[model samples]
Target: MNAYLILDLSINNFESFREYIEKIPLFIKKHGGRYIVQGVEPEVMEGDWCPERVVILEFPSKENAKEFLGDTEAQPLFSIRHKSTTSKLILAEGCS
Candidate 1:
């Protein structure tokens, strides 16, 4: 099955987060991942949950998602993201 990485982020440091975002395209390319959604505006018609930003990345499989997350080359950029935002991330298999 295909896999997806979903992120809901609330940014505290916009400038630093911008830097992190700038670096992500190249990082994703290196890791064999592609952006399905990046910083997309979400419509919550009736919900208590209001997310600041949402991102979804599609990978070939769960193992690929894990490898991308665990890549040493990606760690510094990921650390910047960690420091700049509060985020919830999940790796899930996509339905056929």
Candidate 2:
């Protein structure tokens, strides 16, 4: 089965977040993850929930998704993201 990492984020500091945005792609590719969606505004169809920005990453499996999240090389970039944004992330298994 595949896995997806979904993110809903509100940016606080764009300058710092830019660094994270630039650097993270290399790490994502290294872990066999690809961006399905990146920093898109949500369009509410039926619910009251609204997100400032959303990102979705697809990986080969749940373990691969976990590995990407846990990658040591991406730790500094992750810190930049953490400091510059308020976000929620979820890892979900995809139907095969």
For model 2, where is the 10-residue window of minimal lDDT?
42-51
Question: Could you tell me the lDDT of residue 43 within candidate 1?
Answer: 85
lDDT of 2 by residue, 1-96 (tens): 889999999999999899999889998998899999999998988887798999999999999999988999899999999999999999999998
Candidate 1 residue 36 Cα shift, in angstroms, is 1.0
Off by over 4 Å in 1: none
**What TM-score should be assigned to candidate 1?**
0.91
Task: Give the C-alpha lDDT of model 2.
Answer: 0.94
Mark the regions of model 2 whose C-alpha exceeds 4 Å error after superposition: none
C-alpha lDDT of residue 50 in model 1: 88
Per-residue lDDT of candidate 1, residues 1-96 (tens digit): 789999999999999988888887886777678999988878887969888789999988888889889989889999999999999999999998
In the order shown, what is each candidate's alpha-carbon RMSD? Answer: 1.3, 0.7
TM-scores of the candidates are 0.91, 0.97
